[model samples]
Target: MTGYVLRRVGVSLVVLLGLSFIVFLMLHTISDSPGRAVLGPKATEDAINAFNAANGYDRPVIVQYLAFLGNLLTGNLGRSYILNEDVSTLLWENAGRSAMLSLSALVLALCIAVPLGIAQAIRKNSFLDRAATSVSYLLYATPSFLIALLLIALLSQAIPLFPAEASQSSSPWAVFTDTRSMALPVLTLTITNLVVFSQYQRSSALEELGQDYIKVARAKGMPERMVITKHLLRNACIPLITLIGLQIPILLAGNLIVESVFNYPGLGLLFLNSLNREDYPVLLAYTLLGGVLTVAGNLVADILVARADRRIELTK
Candidate 1:
């Protein structure tokens, strides 16, 4: 297991390096001049040149890439052009909030999805199952932004349960503690995630129920509860584990829309602000951090899947 973890870490690092290169190249290609973009085209030519020279942007692409990598390895993410703050510091401050929001949504999703999915599978073709299927499909087909808006309209506007704007909270803790302010965003994400997870769980559970072991367990007169919990659910969750791993990154990315709709002060909102301000340092930092997180999440999923099913080989 240790060796497998080490190998995964090494691979993640390599993948992150490649991702950084791609992000850098894409950023460079999209903008005519990094210095001009940062300092503005109205700046004097000498000022632009000076800024470029100071930032090492005037160097060859390879040299700049090497310098960027070196700085990244040393824990330096550079300064944000718009915020005039260290990019690392800004990320550190915002990442926790985003993590909190996403993690809460994930928990809510699992709480609602797993049991409902299992029940639906157990009662296949029944009205309850049909209802579950219809709801899941509806949520899966709906846009996240639309969901957020609908939630805001219903819960925040009409019902007046949750606050419409999440940004009014004084701090991260305040947002978490104040259900009225946090409920809409959390619900939006939970609903979105729940729809997908429940559908996957339902499909996996139905497949596992048809397996020979399930038949044998039933034949042996195992209680329905034991048959489903100890045998069926255990094996059925393998694919769901992988789905969870993949969902981490998607959930994080999707938070952008959720955060925007609710005016939440998280990385998603920060990312949007950075884009609008053309804050390259922040944008690049967020992009690279997201890539690293994605790779790490996949590695964790691989290990967990292997642990859950001994037949799965990590080295292979």
Candidate 2:
């Protein structure tokens, strides 16, 4: 396991390096002048040139890339030209909020999905199973933003159960203290993710039920609950583990839309602001961070799947 983890980490680092370069090249290619983008069109040519020289934008692209890479190795993500703050600091502050929201939703979805799916699978071909399938399909077909808006209208505006939007406080941990503000955003994500998770869970559970072990356990006079809890559930969750690993990064991206609808102060809101301001450094760093998360999530998933199912080879 240790060797496998180390190998995966090494490969992930290489993939991240390539990803960074591609983002860097694309950012540079699209923008004619980073200096003008940062400094504005009103700045004099001399001022822009001076700004470029200071930032090493005047150097060859490869040279600048090497410098960027070196800085990245040492934990410097460069300064946000428009915000006049370190990109790393900005990301550190915002990413925590985004992570908190995404993780909360994921945990809630899993909790609801597991039991709901199991029940549906157990009652297959019944009215309950058909009803659940219909609801899951409806939820899955609905767009996230529309869901958020509806929740805000019903729960926030009409019912007055939760705030329509998150509090505008700048503190990253404010949501923890003010849990009410987190309700709408978390619910939006949960509703969006629930359909996918439940469907997968139902499919996996159904597959496990058809296996010979389930029949054997039942034939041995095991209780129905014991057969499911002791033998079937863990095996059924094996496929779900991989899906969860893939979902982590996707949730981050999906939260962008949800966050915007709720005005939640997370990476999504920050990313939108950066795009509006043409903040190239922040954009580059954020894009690179997404790559890192993708690689890390998949690696974690692979490790989890190995741990969950001993029949699978760890070396793979």
User: What's the lDDT for all of these models?
Assistant: 0.86, 0.88
Model 1 TM-score on a 0 to 1 scale: 0.96
Candidate 2 error regions (>4 Å): 170-173
Candidate 2 per-residue lDDT, tens place, 144-173, comes to 888899999999989999988886767766
Residue-level lDDT of model 1, residues 1-316, one tens digit each, is 6677677778988888899999988876776676887888699899989988988888898898888889999999999977889999998888878888889899989988888888999999999999989988988999999999898888878988767887555366654677777888888899999999998999999998889999999999999999988998888888888888888888879889998888888899999999887888888888887788788789889889888876666444
Best by lDDT: 2
Q: Which ten residues in a row have the lowest lDDT in candidate 1?
A: 167-176
Please state the error at residue 266 of candidate 1 in Å.
0.7
List pairs with backbone clashes in candidate 2. Answer: none
Report per-prediction Cα RMSD to one decimal.
1.5, 1.7
